[model samples]
Target: MPLSARRLVLIAAACILVGILAGRFLFEGLILAAAGIAVLAVALSYGPGSRWFSPVTWVVCVAGTLWTAATAGYWMSVSAAADAAQEVPAVASTLFYIGVGGLVIMAGGVVTAAVLRTLGVRRISSAGG
Candidate 1:
């Protein structure tokens, strides 16, 4: 597949994921969606031969992952407080789980990207030269 086509597919997938997340978590979902879009944009902006360990890419991935983790922590705390107060909503507990899942996924992605970059991995073109 061409790089452009692959990028388009990735963008489409990100949009779909964000939409689903937003539908489930409202404001939190929107925030996460924005983060996802930002990451995609950064990835797309790189040249085909760009180094994976580019400082900008690393910074974006690290920052985004940390942000997601912080948000997840907040949600967990809220759920715990509500539970203690006997006012816990089922939705709150569900959101907490979702947040944790997002955090894990994002963190894993960042780590994978970092490792790939450190190993000097490059994009493999599908079209045989």
Candidate 2:
């Protein structure tokens, strides 16, 4: 995998770890991890320039973004409820941050790749020219 993909995978793995250890939000973590793994696999097999890579990323990105937004909305509603508890689980906060962080990593990877290419920094490319 390219460096960008590898870094994103690491972030995804962290999300899985957070869910497992926290015993909460496992579904969300698994979704992010699976998407990350798929992205990495697609990038490696077809190369970043191949037609398959961007579509895979787009599908996963959209799904993950929607899921994250729904989760955030649910959290907001619960916190706003009349009977809402005063204290929130620390793990819940961590998991939320990790999910958002994974998204950021994905986006950052794309931007980094584009910037590097634009700047003639293909040395970081998997081809290693």
Candidate 3:
């Protein structure tokens, strides 16, 4: 894909917004938040033109989103189990489910992103040729 100034700005804006949201929920300390912002800023700065950005973005996005989902799932499961069985098995179940679900979600996200990227490449190639 052709890297345009407009696209770069849009990607930067998106990365900044996502980084802020991730920081708000995932980070407990100011340093971590700052790190997140810095990482995102770099991603945005290099994304539009860099060959590595698309894959890196896809990997990070998929991993981050799945991590978020997994943590959320684990908390929810633990809450439900604590309310229900009050047993060690229930706690284990909660952990297992959360871990498995997170993995599945992460893999799914990667596959989905790969498909989208493939389609994008196809479209661009078709347009050019």
Candidate 4:
């Protein structure tokens, strides 16, 4: 199937929802892990020449990484604060890990996309020269 901006957005949204919902379940960690893997797979599926690697893609990836990181930090802080009064919820921990994993995967996807673009450019230049 062809990858488009709308599709990517939808995939990201779905992954986010999955992570949030799965955090409340027994298999939270496993479900979040699966979501992280799926996000990475979707990001990697885009080719260098595809619009999936456009400037908007970089913006989205960077924004997503930052958002996830910030969210993870916030959750960690809340967990720490709760340690004195009560045990932290499993959902909070699950969300924190999911955020971290998502951040890493998104950043990696951006770097990989840039590398692929560079390699494609080099290949084209060498072939034409």
Query: Over the stretch 99-118, how does candidate 4's per-residue lDDT look in tens digits?
Result: 67666656666677667767
Local distance difference test values of all predictions, in order? 0.54, 0.51, 0.51, 0.59
lDDT of 3: 0.51
* lDDT (Cα, tens digit) per residue for candidate 1, span 55-100: 5455555655555555555666665777699755456656556556
Residue 111 displacement (Å), model 3: 0.3
- Per-model TM-score, in order, reads 0.41, 0.39, 0.38, 0.44
Give lDDT tens digits, candidate 2, residues 1-129.
456666766766675566455545334554444454434433333235424345545644654564466455445544555257556655556656655665665555555545544554455554685
Give the Å error, residue 62, model 1. 0.8
In model 4, what is the error at residue 103, expressed in angstroms? 1.2
**Which rank order by TM-score, best down to worst?**
4, 1, 2, 3
Off by over 4 Å in 4: 1-84
TM-score of structure candidate 2: 0.39
What's the ranking of the predictions by lDDT, best on top? Answer: 4, 1, 2, 3
Model 3 segments beyond 4 Å from truth?
1-88
> CA lDDT of 62 in candidate 4?
59
Worst 10 residues of 1 by lDDT: 44-53
